[model samples]
Target: MSHPVKLYVYDLSNGIAKQMSLQLTGRQIDGIWHTSIVVYGREIFYGQGLTETVPGRSHHGSPVQIVDLGTTDIDQDTFNEYLAEIKEHYTAEKYHLLDFNCNSFTNDCAGFLTGGSIPEYIKDLPTDFLSTPFGAALRPTIDAMFRRPTPGTTPAQVPTPTPVSTQPMPNPELVGSILQAVAAQAQRTGQPAASTPQATTSLTSPLHPCANSASFKSLLKTHRAVVACFSNVVTCPPCRVIAPIFEDLAHKKGLKSGGGAGAVFTKIDLATPSGQALGSEWGVRVMPTFMFFLDGHKIAEMKGADANELRTQIDLLLYQAYPPHKHTSLSLPAMQSLSLKPILFSQVPNLDAVANKLLSSITSVNNSERVKQIITGSVVPYLKSRSSTKALPTVLVAWTEVTSTLSSSLPPESLFPLVDMWRLALLDPAVATWCAANFSSSPLVTLSRVASKLSIQQCPRPYALTLLRLLSNAFSSNVLAPRFFIGNFRLEVIALVIPSLLHGDGSVRNSGASLAFNMAAFLQTGRAEAVRNSNGGGTVKSDMEDEEWEIEMVSAVVEAIDREKTSEDVVHRLVASIGCLLRLSPFYDTQVSSLLEVLQAKQILKAKLQPGQCGEKGVEKKEVRKLLEEVANKLCA
Candidate 1:
């Protein structure tokens, strides 16, 4: 049997490019093309990495055009292997809008599967757009829009466009004359003119030479751990031998670990006058001497060109700075192997039905019209177009206002519809990013207010369930999860979640379990990454690590497991959360392990795993029982 392969074409600009291209650029561009490959009943696309979904269900929504690219005889397993290889080359970090994008991925896949290419115009869109004078002028704007998020800053920090009147305008007549000249030159020479060259900023490596005492002092001040090599490569043979080794370590340990958040490696040339001044100041008497500085103070010094000793000292410096978590030494294979991806509830209900329910439930005549406009005009369209394009700032601001208003004015019982809407919107990365950056003003405030109401008042099940789901969806943003875990709002969010674990309703309990799992997964991922990157040295403590938070969370989960009697699904998830929280925990010996012992977690889990005591039947019950056994064994160990 053979599977049919197809090409899905989307308009990155919707229909605006077709409508405005001639007037704006003096060219007839059909659309700003984005594409994906459809095969084996799945739509595979690239943006934030290569993602697969059901046909017509990607964030891009329905494709503007679909091209049949014949059939492929390759089996699913074979194609998957091919996809794995392709994934390495098309990673989220490497994604570039104009240079390399969705169309590039699809075109490659299409050629491999069906010996065909995506349309020439689609493949050449970037070149065509850049060829225009207006497009050339707009290059920097486009680059700014699509630039990757910096390590320390969120994407929300990127500037949005201001009003045209606020900025200086280019001369239309001059632009027209330039375009005409290029066209006339092309006609005369029977060839197209070259595109205007674009300027690119070059990145400097983490390992570079320090020229002076000021530069050396600045390096030590800026970095937590500075590895300074006092060597003149031109004069000394030993310096030449150790220079490459130092550079290799710098690239590996310094650059790879969160962009030099770890140790920074630099060398000082003794031959130079400034380097000589720095050497005399630091008392560097020997050539090829290595010195380690932690927090701007000299910690250790080494002489001669010993590569192994250099590597060892650097590792020791990192270890002293960042001790490994106590749990890393434990033999908890099951916990160590747990997935770190968040547990998200992203099933979107019908927007029309949700909107209708919200409108019908708003009893206040004064606020009803305003809420309606916000939902139907702002929220609905934003959600609808979110997969295809970024939402306008006005829409997000409108959402914040409406959510705040509704949470304040509407009864707790009548807020589920609004909460549900916000939950659905958080599934989009843009909305999630905005919510994270504007934490105080976002729907999170609404969620917190509702949670506070639940703490005191009798809240409706639908509202509670939707609220839990909303919290789970908030973990969808990589930027938001860290803030949610350890930011100022951490305790408030945790307090809201703990009680829900013991809710009477099974659905509420399940949703709460999902939320717990997300929190644990976030914490676990940080710990795991730190351990993996530590290379047998002491692991750096994750920002997500909080002794109090982990202890509180694990204690609640164990209690939830003891109380949960009906749903095996809920029990399984609860166990997973416990496993994640306990694994690679820095406070395992001092706090978490003792807390589990005090809570009688092993006994509770042992009771649950006994023959018929498990909630579910067949394979589900078997899996839950198996997980319970694994957790119980870890406790014993």
Candidate 2:
């Protein structure tokens, strides 16, 4: 027996604009087509977990439901706003579920709401459910919306003028006469016209107008348009006429479009613009430019275009990218390439740029496989051949994007080239500043990139303190794999970052302690020695005494810790690292005396008594005093 399907009306305005009916399929049916539901007006209830058991069910279960009234037609702006609200109101997984369900109502809604968006807010839910009946229903709507044309008045049609060939004719006499007329014109204009064989007559005669000449009449029909003003490049009259038409068309397409909503089409006029101005301003020297922009920033472009050719290019571009009205903030595919899981490395905002460039280069190389010698050359380098400054960053950024796109391991050789590219970016003060700025904004992402790069042995120079500091900061936030870095760096990144704990900046202090805690946890064995060797280069000789290495490293860490200020909460971390290190195999017992010296130097062992902290007459005055007494006894013993 078929269950009666119920209609779920969705009203997008108040946030709940749709209703879905579920039929019980089994004894205990739980899962349905989950999507991100916007529970705008739903009453939210929060309570602590119950300790006692319910009468018939497990006591562990908590009852909670996010009720969304319905979902309906929403423009891109409203859609983003809705999504942002949903993200704030629910967990990413929950929101992702809601998004899937919401998108399934219509194809346009699916693409509009989920397209080009970061799933950080929705990834945990079962993406497979996106194909469910609820999900399937929305697919058609999303597809339809995404397929809608970008708003622009249809291009005014122009009459197609007949094509005239400039090819030469076979008659020698006709060619001779045309040549003489060309010479006569050149003579009048005080310019020399070179002699041509009679067979080349068609070229010379086309420039002259002779009423009685059949060749001249034929030339008029053949050359429908002539250059009004001669120029070496594409400013010939016919091309110039077409250029403005394209410019106008691009402007109309770009009128209301900008930002990540979608790119707009624009034109950069070369002739109306002065010498080197267009090239300098827009970075081009060619004519008949056609550009695609997002919020006035040029992202993709072409130059030296004709009418039919320009139309083809526009169609191709539109096919690849949706218009603003049809777009969501970001595409799912593009956003996935930017996510943490598939990248295999830690996240870095700068690496996002790198990844994008790599993907672009890969695409270009693959696309041009069939047109090598005809275009740039068959073995066209995967990277661009522009000057080093232009090419290096592009290639590195591209590599980063590609690695993020590909879920599996990339070749070591492929990464070596990117390492060089990053090295170049690091050396360029401006580029380094940019990288640092991005790190500041998204520490987790930046730290992940650094960690991944290190894992691949990509750091070319002595690891900069700045790079280590960034990782340390990220570790402090507990936003990255602190153990990976702590185990990898030879020098105690924690020790260096620990001083930040005492700095004037409170955030720095917090970050420092975090780094120290994780670093201590990671330095379980002789990993520090390996790290030291990697960074400082065998400063500890292979033949050096094992006991001596222990003493040196312990002393270094203690000294670094002791240098921190009294107000800083670093003593706890220092003690923790020391405790962990001692518990690990290959103990550094010789450093015990050094550690005591450093502790004493910082007056860290000094006991303090608060007014209300006194113990009974027979008891120890303070915990520290009792502990110190025991320590003194041991040292003396």
Candidate 3:
């Protein structure tokens, strides 16, 4: 049955915004709007993460306006499933007052349920506010207000809307204990854990506030590069002048390097007693003094407030901290332009045929009958109707049971159809998330096991191809991908993929190339983020693991490129994988560079770039040749 969906709009300013906006911004905004979706006897909004409350009983009190958003035929079970899938994207740490706030979440939910959008006026509040001169001036203030708390700030100080849940929430401390136990067990056994996903703090705001001496010390200890500005904002005019410039530089550099791992910008006001003591300890008497710190020691300082000088020094610090890879200087536009998106095999096969094949492969009468029912009763219907509605949690639970039974009993060669079916279902983010979170029984574990059982040289073509595609599709889940990179899982993946790269079967090689590309893309993205956050340079083992994985993949890819005499498509994918592995890589100067030299990777690639040597002559071949040349240049230069 269809249910009514309404938008609950509240004025955060309590009707005062309309009265004062004209005077404050010289442009009248009707309200400082906060919105929520009211459906299924609950009011849902994004604040301190996704929250639900009894209608009209939220902390916002009663909404000023309720807009009829039309009705949705989506059932409560389906909607709840949808909520679980979307919750990860809407964490409290990810909320931004001017960007992704309450209105944005409502609009997303509205579209999902009703295939419509919230009113433009309500959605456009941030844009409208920022366009105004006064509103533009308030951007930094809005950012700082919503930013995650820096060190030394109590959790109570961070603004969070208290959620009134329909049911009692789980004990947070108990949940933490469970997660710690799981992680510990996983570490002891060298297995990947199904630990609860933690919300990562968003680093949207580059400037981290140093509240006192303790916070300042903590910041220096944690961050590799920090730019500390010591000044009294209330008393120092020059401090005010250079403040914006410093902030702007932080944002720019933070963006370039990726936040968190990059340089951290902080300000200490000498007007406060704590700030006064900090300044004394740093021996700063000037009205505005800029100190550059690397490895927790002050390396450079400037007494005057010079914008150009500040920019220059900050650039130098970043350069010294994160030296550009030699490949970055090469003219390799084709390699540079390679898209880092995961290469996915998403084509849907005949579901009935696949189900029949799976049923025929099962030997146990009871298990066979149960699997058949799941295919017809839950899995098939869910896959068909997933576009318009969500499957109940039980649908996935049933599939999980069926997967465990078959994956354990079925022979390695007989598992292709089952793996193929799982691959199709995993395209749904909901299923992917469930699989990612349920580590032990995850079909991904089954896929990995099946790959391990099959000899890389003698595996059936269909089974090998399906396994490769299944691994590729696993990257669909943001949650699963990261987990896959941890513990022994990463090594298992390397073991499966390296041999497949040089498989005698051309189709298996193609599938293997696609999987390799996906793996490389994942690493490249993480490396880029680390560089942006200034986390790439340290002796962190996670960084080392990533470097090791890349070096192994690159070695296999270069050999694959040399052996590949046909299929421009495979060549393109293989070269693209090499590019991603090398680009923005921290170990390019040492491990990766030395490996490339030993392999004579540049010469092998240049030989492939020669006309008629790599693949059949066509537009695709020309593209492959171009990529090969670029990769060759990046390798040698």
Candidate 4:
């Protein structure tokens, strides 16, 4: 059931939306009214930088035409969360009419909804107006009253900012009472009593917060190391802004969370009486202050909400308390005992013929960095064109010969030029597509296996990672998909390919994900090809056996998703693969079905992509959500 997302646009200039446009550029300007998103006939609106909520009659008194933004599979709660994140950033304090406004918010929501921006003309209205000389001259007059209008109330009645408490607070009695109350609560809650810090426990979480001087003393005594955050939750906005960041670093690091001997985190709210006393005791007046302590003595203090300074100071404390684990870096023993196996093929009838020709005539190495030229120079032109089936077999056989003749005494670096050339060939989509049809056979398997051998856990060599990624890239073309289920081929492919999903190297895991997507592409194209043939295309493609591809490849993809569950990149690719597989599956594979629920249960749905992560290639957040929704609705419903 698809829900059409309608944007209920209103021009704020009463009926002068056309006049406002005339004052600016010739863009289609919806009269300057506020806007809201109506989904399922519910008008969802935002105001004064608040989260999306059902609006009263004040907004959208007379709305413009409702835009049918296609449809979305996003549920209300998830959509609301996206709105909340927007509200957090586009707060009343931050909303600028010329910069960020309701239209900007609507544009963001529309982008999330349909993977398209709201009509460009509406989005550019403010900018269009501001750019003109007449509009520019009147901007100050117009901007003052319009940006953040209180829908139901006037500006005078808007909540006033709370003043920071500056009165000298040396309330020892109150501080002692607060400490006793916390201590009593801890006892009743069965929290660990104040005791000496133990190496095994990591002395509570670095984000374990304290409210007053007494709690701070208790934590300082118990943990022996502390990073106290002096923030104001009541009056200071930046203090509130930096509060979560202060805790997030601790949570991500987990040093103070019983992972190792790490620094303990404590919070002091200047708004409270004990907090006020503590602030005065520390000789601090400003909000969002940070002070580092060891053994109940302060060694460093930061006076502002500077993220860099906070991180640096916290890192300094963590370094002092819980130094880096010895095994974080690659060690000598792990490298010396590296046990790498080369991936192999099940059937190669013409191997000897190809190997004999390759062994007898080796291509000379060139000084240039162009790898495709080098490999092509070594082999025939048929391989590069990808027009003939004979090209794949010859290439595989030729590659296998190179690996077989190599001595164990030879260092992996000795084959750098050869690997570089291979990597380059795989870089080409034509070559990659042609190569993927070979599926789980010798050349691809051997290449991956050899790359795996070089991948020592916690000691990933750049070359090994690069080769694996290239092999993964090679499989990305559509040539392999239409032929994945011809006979016993799919099973053989899975047997050769699946273990790499669990490779300890994150880059290798990412590569395995790429390969899964490639296979998924094959699955989708294969299904479409089937539909095409069924619908009277005379191209009668061969035996796509029932339940075989789904049983083997779906299981392979599910296991791959499980193996790299922690990796968002891997999971993103795996989820896409599984979604395709489910559509392709005659009976939606149970393992794949359950996996979606597992991901949701584990909060993998809530997990955010890192900076610069805009999903895999062109697929963005909207697509990801749709894939998730398809699984959830079908399986759970």
Please report the candidate that would top TM-score against the real structure: 3
Give the range of the ten consecutive residues with the poorest summed lDDT in model 4. 160-169
Q: Give the CA lDDT, 0 to 100, for residue 160 in model 4.
A: 18
Give the Cα-based TM-score of candidate 4 against the true structure: 0.31
lDDT by residue for model 4 (137-209), tens: 3333333322344457444321211211211111223323432332222122123333321111112223443
Local accuracy of candidate 1 as per-residue lDDT tens digits, 55-92: 88765668899988889887888778667755755655
Question: Which ten residues in a row are the worst by lDDT in model 1?
Answer: 196-205
RMSD to the true structure for each prediction, in A, is 21.4, 32.1, 19.0, 27.0
User: TM-score for all predictions?
Assistant: 0.62, 0.22, 0.65, 0.31
* Model 1 stretches with alpha carbons more than 4 Å out: 1-205, 208-226, 255-262, 272-274, 277-283, 292-301, 316-333, 376-393, 611-620, 635-637
TM-score of 3: 0.65
lDDT of 2: 0.30
**Model 3, runs deviating above 4 Å:** 1-214, 254-261, 384-388, 525-545, 610-620
Q: Is candidate 2 or candidate 3 better by TM-score?
A: 3
Query: Residue pairs in steric clash, candidate 1?
Result: 59-387
CA lDDT, every prediction?
A: 0.69, 0.30, 0.69, 0.48
